[model samples]
Target chain A: MFRPCGLFDETYAKNIAIVRTRQHWILIIIGLFIFLTFPLYLSGRILHFINLLGITLIAVQGLNILTGFTGQISLGQSAFVCVGAYTSALLTVHLNFSFFLALPCAAIITAVIGTIFGAPAMRIKGFYLAMATLAAQFLIPWMVTNVRTDLTGGSQAMHVPAPSIGGFVFNDQQSIFYIIIPITCLSIFLIRNLTRSRVGLAFLAIRDNDLAAETMGINLTKYKLLAFFICSFYAGVAGSLWAHWMRAISPDQFNLMESVWYLGMIIVGGMGSVIGVVYGVLFIKVFDISIILIGPRLTSFLPPQLAQDTAAGLAPFTFGMIILVFLIFEPRGLAHRWEIIKGYFRLWPFKY
Target chain B: MLLFVQFLINGILVGGIYALIALSIVLIYKSTRVFNFAIGEMMAIGAFILYTFLATVKFSLWIALPMTVISTLIIGFFIERLALRPLIGQPILIAIMATIALSLIFKGIVFFAWGSPIICYPERILPGEATMVGKLFLSNELICTFLITISVFISMSLFFRFIKTGLFMRATAEGHDLAQASGINVERIFAVSWAIAAMIAAFGGIMLGIRFGIGIGTLPLVAIKAFPAVLFGGLESVLGAVIGGLIVGILESFVGGYIDPKFSEITPYIILLLILLFRPEGLFGLKRIERI
Candidate 1:
């Protein structure tokens, strides 16, 4: 059991030499990041960005489960998140329910919808699965706007009031920040521990090879649906928080673009790593927010008309370009890059 | 009955436009097995080019149309080389995301280059509606639509049938490895496929602009509509593309004419979802499981 403690066989010995770092170093890096981020939260310019980062981190966690764990590709994760957002918003605002009451129900409702939509999973995988999700992307938004127009507020956007607890209102952006950050941290910890457990192992097993896993007596349907449920449940939680944080719910927020951003977070963050989700969200979302702020500054040298034209367009273009550049050259992402820097220190003076 | 015929005429005209649009998607997938999600945006870019060239540069249609086609072809070829070629042996999902990213980038770039406002394509053809076969009403726009559709169809059919360049493209599309083994330049052929797809998209966009005038704000939705057309016809077959386009166009027309005004607009996509549930392969599409 302690063989990976630099006392292992040939393969692990070589790997550990490369990857294993003193635990204190990672702690320091994380600690430093938190310290830097703490000051940003104090500033007004970044409160909204930080809150968005928190919600995105949660959404990426859900995606990490589907893509990073179960090997499913979904472009409709935003739709599931929308499901949770609308459900929770509806419950809290119209039904006069509390966040605590609405949150679980929201997650449950999203899970149920995810599993049902995921029923097509038995027959489809890869690009076919992608197409199916694309269908869901079109379907849910259409349903919310067209069929359940009144309830979903159609395209007019719905107001989700600030969450209240007992007698206290978690009203402002700062208060919502407190709620989101802790939930994000808790989810990260829970997913990390959960993946180490039997359920997580099963998901990984299924991801690696469904046939092999099934022959080992893992029920493919049960486990696959469970993954859909769990993954989507996480999306629900993220959505509920976002609905409250933004104090609004519009189909625009859950458009296909957001889904692609979430996928970018997973791929560019480092697939199959919990730290990847957080890093991906923070790195991408922060860069995105920074671009919105700094894009015009860079383009200020350009003609005034040109600068105005480039402002709205440059952010999405830069994001897509970054994703392309990173995917082509740095598929392992920032988490893996950070791992490498730590490795150089851990292996100092050992020339191996 | 006159209303039905009028809607049918409009449907077929628009359907022909959609057929050209879906052909871009089908052609790319045929050779490379990569679904080019950026086709609609490519169409939008073409429309933007033509829109700007005529309105801003005051270029002739003959010059502007070819210019748009050539530029878009270059863009598509570069995208394949820059975004997709590196991901050659990577999973299909990477390619899908790459193309999706390309689509987003295209949307962003176009949204930037051409402001997001809706720019109508100025009417160039003479204004005259004609009564054909006693009850059938035809216009210069409809005639142009028919002519463009037929010419595109004939040229493509001949290109694949008789042209050596077309043969190489078809071979590359059919299977890259086999084409490579047969001494064909497979990578070059893939680039050619993208160029050809872009050309078709450009043609479609120009035609649509000429027919309905380009609506800049709603260009993204054009590709979104084309998806269901591809869904109806099966993603891989050329004939299926035409058939699917016509069916969706006609069905949508009938629904818009007879059904509730709101629901009519959604009829095509709703039908597409229903068709997908029962026949995932689509009409005239070969049944394919996930893996070979």
Candidate 2:
């Protein structure tokens, strides 16, 4: 609907399509082709890194819906992931369900649990809601580790079987990438459409002003809980995918730090937009992975004791600095920057 | 019964330390309307500073104690001036995220300085002997810490009630714009509140370090534990934080002693969730009303 320059939409379907122009379609195809063929030329480590990005993007996408779209901050995202991971793992290992069958089931169960936790959002907002949701961060892990040691494997990690689709086993890194890529693309496409739908408008309304939304006859309780459910469902799918890919699950994998990282991703990428999720996850994850990779090499030149300290502190210190800088100077995030660049190109040959 | 009493006593003693930290959090939230997530790091840094001064620099307790408090107060003031001051009029979410970043930075700094090893405070700073009183044994350090905590509380309560500066802080807490209109110099009050909070956190940190030794990861855990207390007592009420801290401490102790040790870890959070469900504003907190 929003046409710039000489761009025009001739049909209703064309106007609503995500890839608006022919140029957009061509770029998307080229991007997908590059990603699809990367395994041929890239190392297993790089593939593994993309695999992590894919999984985290899925979860961050969920967080974008809750915190970004709906304006409800949840520090309990890791807990929701834990539920999904454990549920999928349990269904496969204990009940002998297939990975495909278990993944959606796990997501649904996590959604139910997420909805329960999100019930407080109707009455509380802002920091109070953040604190209340933190209960999930503390409680879910405790429950997994303590309540039923048998099903969850307690403090010990549970093993997952390699998922197979009609005799093709997704066991190797490349094979897992095949599974991850499709799911990741599907999630992005679906969420992109979701944010453009009526439900998304309601979520945006709630985020902007809950009281105003309520007065406008938007059922705060229903929509807020729905956002929680949908968001947690995304986390569930990510957790399920991760579990099957890693072939092992543990409470430690989905901890408070990971939840915070997911939040940082949305904050850094830009909130309220679908593509922002991608940019945020890619930026933070790449930064983080680079730190892990380069930290040791950078520290090797220092004295052994000091090196150890520096190596330990470098990642968090830099990550914190990035978050601080973004919040202070560029609170709009990477997605906003992307738009600015696009605008510059669109307005090229003419000074603003 | 005696065991229960022992746990109760231990809980109370530990609760005193939590009360100190919760009070600091409550102070900042009251005055600045910002829930500082960096508090645990503040405490950890304070403890580390005390360790550096006393163990590394060879300062005596009498000198090191005041030095640690003063330096930590300055650190707190800088955090407000640098990190939080720029965040005025921002959404609560952005401010909270900033504090989280500040916490990470503080944690990184401490890790860079001291690494991950647990650092023990010098034993000479506090009495180490255990004393018996009617079949119960109490650590002399715990007793000393408890006494200091009581004195701090009494002095703080008096300060808020009577002192001119404290009155300015209270006024500022009531409404920043109103206080500014009344010529209260709200920015100075904000800095002072943060300083006072930081000093209290430093005190708690020193005591806890003396009790359990200071570790990078465990120091921040204190802030997480203090959350339920701050919420339970009410974020805006100092007295509420004190009571909430004690309740949480004793609840954790009883649960750990009776039900399961693991339950103690989540007891505070569970209480927080329950409190939020039943009373979103908290016991002593003012009801927040949304305007259309």
lDDT tens digits, residues A249-341, model 1? Answer: 888778888898899888888877888778888888878878888988988987887777788778778888988888898887888887877
lDDT of 2 by residue, B71-119 (tens): 9989989988988888888888888889889888988899789888897
Residue-level lDDT of model 1, residues B103-143, one tens digit each, is 77887887578766666776563346654767776766666
State in Å the error of residue B76, model 1.
2.5
* Stretch of 10 with least lDDT, candidate 2 chain A: A1-10
Q: Kindly report which residue pairs in candidate 2 clash with one another.
A: none
Chain B: TM-scores of all predictions: 0.91, 0.96
lDDT of 2 by residue, A1-352 (tens): 2236677778999878887778989998999999899888899989988998999999999999999999999988989998998889999999999999999999999999999999988788889989987888989988999987977889898999989889988888888898899999999999989988999999999999999998999999999999999999998999899899888788888888888888888889987878888999999998998898899899999889889889889988888899888888888799888888888787787766
Q: Each predicted complex: what DockQ?
A: 0.51, 0.80
Clashing pairs in 1: B31-B173
Q: Which ten residues in a row have the lowest lDDT in candidate 2 chain B?
A: B121-130
